[model samples]
Target: MDMVISNLQQQRAVTEQLRREAAIKRMLVSQAVADIVKFINEHEQDDCLLHGFTSQRINPFREKSSCTLI
Candidate 1:
């Protein structure tokens, strides 16, 4: 009876430890995804700013046009 009780306690402890490790892994994964999204947003904002600054000097391509296209 004492041996059975000891085995049950060990199993319970192991299960709890696994659950805590899984929770920590999930939190790390979520944080990594959030960081990636933030980096992408910052890169997009930089691209938009660059395009805005260069747009005035850029020329439009036209195959055929009666009037000047800008």
Candidate 2:
């Protein structure tokens, strides 16, 4: 009877440890996803700036003339 009780207690401890580890892993994954989304947003804004797509109150759909007459 004592041996059976001891075995049950050990199993419960192991189960609790596994549950804690799973919770930590879930938190880490959530943090990593947030970081990745922030990085992508920043990268997109930088790309737009690099390509002259600014929001400084300028025309964004204007056409340029490339012909000259002498």
Candidate 3:
């Protein structure tokens, strides 16, 4: 049916648009990761990375949790 065909075409168009948006997001993430890699490489010899762990987990491997529960 003509209506069925039109619906299929519309779905395909929507899918293609979503694919394009996902591809763009992938590109942005790739670029961000590349920038982070470059930054880490540039700072590999410094103490910068160690202190850059999770917000307050500066010494990530330490036995005591930074926040003590009451």
Candidate 4:
């Protein structure tokens, strides 16, 4: 039927749009992660600690080894 065909076309369009948007978002997140890693690596030092996706200059514990207690 014509109506069924049209509905399928609309659904396909929506699916394609969602895929494009997801790809764009994925690229943006990848770029952000790369930037964060570059920054951390550049500024990394004896006292620097990377916690998850972020970096901190000061150790969170009294002993440096305690930071790796995770």
Alpha-carbon deviation at 25 in model 4, angstroms? 3.8
lDDT per residue (tens digit) for residues 1-70 in model 3: 9999999999999999999988873458789999999998888767555555555566665678488689
What TM-score quantifies how close candidate 1 is to the native fold?
Answer: 0.36
lDDT tens digits by residue: candidate 1, 1-70? 9999999999999999999988873458789999999998889866645466545444343244478679
Query: Candidate 1 local accuracy as lDDT?
Result: 0.75
Clashes of 1: 0
Tens-place lDDT digits, model 4, residues 1-70: 9999999999999999999988873458789999999987877763234433233434354445435454
Model 2 stretches astray by more than 4 angstroms: 26-70
Per-model tally of clashing residue pairs: 0, 0, 0, 0
Question: Which residue runs of candidate 1 sit more than 4 Å off their true CA positions?
Answer: 26-70
Please report how far candidate 4 places residue 4 from its true position, in Å: 0.0
Please give the range of 10 consecutive residues that has the lowest summed lDDT in model 3.
Answer: 47-56
TM-score of each: 0.36, 0.36, 0.36, 0.36
List candidate 4 stretches off by more than 4 Å.
26-70
Off by over 4 Å in 3: 26-70
User: lDDT per model, in order?
Assistant: 0.75, 0.79, 0.79, 0.71
Task: Give the clash total for candidate 3.
Answer: 0
Residue-wise C-alpha lDDT for candidate 2, range 1-70, written one tens digit per residue? 9999999999999999999988873458789999999998889756655677555446455575589889
